[model samples]
Target: MLIGAGYFFELLCTGQLKPVAGQPIFQETRFGWVVSGPADNVINSGGWAASAVNLSITENTETDLEQSITTFWKLEEYESKSVYTKEEKECESHFDNNINRDESGRFRVRLPFKKNDYKRDTQLKQDYIKCMSEYEALEHMERVDNEIENKDREGKYYIPHHAVRNDSSTTTKLRVVFDALIAEDRRDFQHVLWRPEPTQPIHVYRLNTLTYGTVPASYLATACLENLANTECDSCPEVGELIIRDFYMDDYLGGAMSKAGAIQLRDDLISIMSKAGLELRKWLSNDPELIVNVHSDNNNIRGRGQCPDSQAKILSEIATIFDPLGLFGPVIIIAKIIMQKLWQIKVNWDDVLPDNICAEWQRYRDGLPSLNNLRIPRKIISNKIVVITEIHGFVDASEKAYGACLYLRTTGVHKNIDVKLICAKSNVAPLKIVSLPRLELCAALLLSRLRNKLIPKLNLKINRRRFWTDSKVVLAWITSPSGRWKTFVAHRVCEIQELAACSEWSHVPTHDNAADV
Candidate 1:
């Protein structure tokens, strides 16, 4: 019997019915036709009728073979849902046990196999679709919707499942799920699954972009492109803001303005300043003279360099001195501070900071006391002026490896230690733009270079040239007792110790340290 609504069984063979003397017998298709032995045949032929035991496959031959297979076996027909549920358990068990059985309870019957078996392929595809549909329904049971929560912590928040899936970080998770599906599908063989392409951000062009207040769009564009590969989207906008701000503040306005270039980059800087919203008032300008301290050559500790700690101290002192009105002091005494302590890690400017770059610095000043007293001696201040040597690269051909510079100053004034670029004899070795620790060693080596070439060159020098940079970590590392800097910095430290026999160096904060500009 056909078990359920969408199914039918093909009758390949049939049983026969016996005829009686007075009654005509007919075969029935509903219940399988049954045959009985006749009494006369039972006596003559050992109780078996010839026609009763013999059965034949009924066929309309060529035409009926295809029609019968299609109609009764449902090679291409819609299966009712109820019939699917009825057959599901049996089919599932057969698949699970790697056994195949016909719906009529027949076993071990082999059908002719063909390469393009469309009926079996279609059934297999439908089975997977059913499984996936059921799987999604189960997974969605706990949460039908996603939610996101914004916490007050810095750089941190919670994202719901929907948000998580949308983020780039979740690409791996998607890949894992896809891999699992592929693995399940091709369980008998090893196979690789293809993944979707990753999405990338669009870069938009901005006009009126300022480079040192001069609108050097070309230079700014080049710098932006140089660091483009390192750029990631996490804080892309914030980094962009810094690029814009630094171009204006550092290249045009900072003490290192002349180092930027010709074309008088910011020829009308004052007008540019007007656009930036800084009004130059007469009373604001008249209050105090700007003092700039240049610590060009000491390697032991930062003596005159405006280290962050010292710079903070100086700003506080001025705030104390000028902060009477509470409002005016914050505006007046505090110098514009730009710190680049980590700039070395990000940029190795050995290419831009050329070899044999002309430099002049103030020699070490004597009669200076340690910073513990918080007083800068007058003699040291008055006598401070040293001729700076040309800074060169670590190699003759490569220009990227260049020496470090440190500068400090008060608000609103340019100090007499103003620098100008000029061609000079190539005397110093090129500096190496290695790691931070190595860079510190390079700075120390540069100081030692000054002592070797300058101390005897200056009759044992007045006292000692002060070295300054923004790396407090480097400073502490080099100055620590029994400091174990890497061999490069250690070697440089030894040179510094010998140079200390003549002069001293100091570490400074990046804010008050202007050389980074």
Candidate 2:
């Protein structure tokens, strides 16, 4: 009976069945009653057995996903290791042998496939037929003559393909994916699609261009772009450099100092990319006039949406701001402080914010509209030649945050002095309690880093750079030797010293420090 019970007695292992004190318990099953309780040691006294199992599952959070994506793309941006496999070498050789320019100067490339024969899947053939019918209707593929014999298919290989449909895709809602591993049998059969008709024989078709989802599609496309840039470098060096440095995949991101410079750069980019059969569209710029001629429909520009009423919505709104230079650091810091507070209290993203924070956020959101009235010169100074240029940086720290701002001071040929704010950056104070003097030092270090980064990028010939802070303790730390301070202070002071000389840093009255805002 026990043998036939099978898993009926498994509950005893689960510990859910409790024995009555000195009483036997019976459970009814298809095999009959089973008794279990505290019993005299009959077999246990002679032997002992033990078993254990452990399991763990970890999920990728949003932060982890973002970090992984950053790391993956960073590898692509840098040169690969100084090593190559046989397959890699072959791929490079094939690209060089088949890549060429057409009569219109557009680049043409071929697929890279290993020399191997692969078996075909029946389901793949059915999918290919269904997809090719749509492709022929759209005029994306043409049918070949049926007179071609099987002997003529020597260099041709059939590719297994299937259609993928995504309702959320803004562009092509449906696209066909070709499997590279199964499609590697023939070099000439890049994509062998077929369509059957009741009254006629099955027709064969092939995709002309490089198909997405292929193993070497991304490599081939990137190589083609690099080749275009290299070939055109002699005639358009600047544009070629921009294409190499500024392009992330198909998008081009760059800037110029003046309207004329921007226009010239735009024309050069269009001319060069057009040579490779690439036309840039949907151009966007901070200056409306720059894109007015290209995008005549002003409605295409995104307009402000309804005000955010929840924490999640507010965060989404904040992410939409496009201030890369941190020119609005002072105004933006308020929002950052609110966000930090929300995180501190461990507020749910979609939950209603606390009354105090919600009120503060609402006030900040309401005042944002007034920013339209604020204006600053795009260029630091007029086109007139300047004899002297200097960068002045200010830093300050409060109990809640620290910030740094830079100003460009120029002396024209007429001895006229012009001062303008160049850029600014700010950060919320760490949640860990810290001394005000330490915060002040952090601010000073922030200013040092900002100056060091801006100087290399600025086109002007800066004669001197100076930093200002309101904290006397910070000035003392900068003047004294870094070895005298603790690890935190010592590290920041050392970096600050390395970035700027002790003499370049000075003290300013609290009221006079612009960063105090």
Candidate 3:
């Protein structure tokens, strides 16, 4: 059976269609009510239906006569039979619900929608937005990248206008040179280069400007590139590669795995830079033969020697080389504690230290000379396949501090399981009083995060992971449901589980925990 356009549209929009005396266009569906005729397309249109009766109002001020009509529709959820209502009062209420007198007066409307529909439509709009965002993703084209780009890579490489004084002999005559870009103060200070001095009345000589002082960063980089460009390195590519990243400003600092490579790089550097009028004179090396070749004038010019006695005095003055591996974290932590103690007493910039502080500082300083004795192996060759490799993390907290440390253990690679301190981190406890258990939990979570990060870079295939903590309370908390704990414990437990789900949690005697150190 076919329905008229008006009836069909009403069926689509309102979930109701009454054919002239005999036909029905509405049908039952799993989703309340929907249109039955024409095609397979259907909607849960019952959710969109207005109130019971349809209200039509028409106003004609020209005659002062207004007419309104009310009509009924069947509902599938509650109505099995058609119901009819013709109440003028229902029209008045619907009109009042939607009306707020405006310049465009509501003259006439065959109540298109009942009052309640507008409220639900507005509320559901946000949910529809979410639904479209999720379900419509595959149907639509991916969003275009509209962000404006700056040529940052090009900008990073730009040299400063002027750098490095050509005449400065603490340095040498550069094989390459650059023009000096004058400073703001010297903008009007330019006298023509190759010209006579200002004091001299004679301008007849070819004008020349005198240049002096430190060179800018830009000129230095360009000069370095130019020098390398001129130097021949086709036969010694390894030395050339070392020189590329090794130079810091004008000084070279680099390392090699083999003494032979070190000797070769040193000799090549001396020969190559000499072409640019630069001398590689002060060479120091661990290998005796390499040192003998350069024959450094200073007797103490030995690599990996003890710290100078004077360098041992000032904590801040001596270079604290950035140790990413945390080999000397315990030693560094001592210095950090001393610094914090100094701050606690409100020590001024130039304050003389208390005798106890100075004595302790001196003792720590004396121990630093011995730290040079520690060395990381260049390589650990193992033929046997790794049977098991495990990372063990230990966490601890005190009134003053909290920390976490990791160790890597490997078996089958060695007769006795080889173990090494992988990395460690520590934090001073906050001034606010906190329960020891909470701090212990914080340390565990920190170690879990460290495990997540270091796992990707580890060369050995890890078979197991473990976390150690002395705090029984924290252990109880982790083994228990998250809801059993308070806010502090619950949040940290959730994070720890997320990051270290594969890790086993275990108790460790406080004396045995390396993190306690």
The top-ranked prediction according to TM-score is 2
Candidate 3 stretches greater than 4 Å from native = 1-315, 318-321, 376-385, 413-416, 481-483
lDDT by residue for model 1 (351-432), tens: 2321211110111111122322432221111223444322211101112222332222112122344332111111112233
- What's the residue-level lDDT of 282 in candidate 1? 21
How accurate locally is residue 177 in candidate 3, as Cα lDDT from 0 to 100?
Answer: 22
lDDT of 2 at 355: 78
- lDDT tens per residue, model 2, 114-148: 64222354554565566778889999977776736
Error of 3 at 58 (Å): 71
Estimated TM-score for each candidate: 0.20, 0.62, 0.42
How far out, in Å, is residue 414 in model 2? 0.8
lDDT of each: 0.33, 0.74, 0.57
Error of 1 at 447 (Å): 2.4
For model 1, state the Cα shift of residue 370 in Å.
44
- Worst-scoring 10-residue span by lDDT in model 1: 358-367
What order do candidates take by TM-score, descending? 2, 3, 1
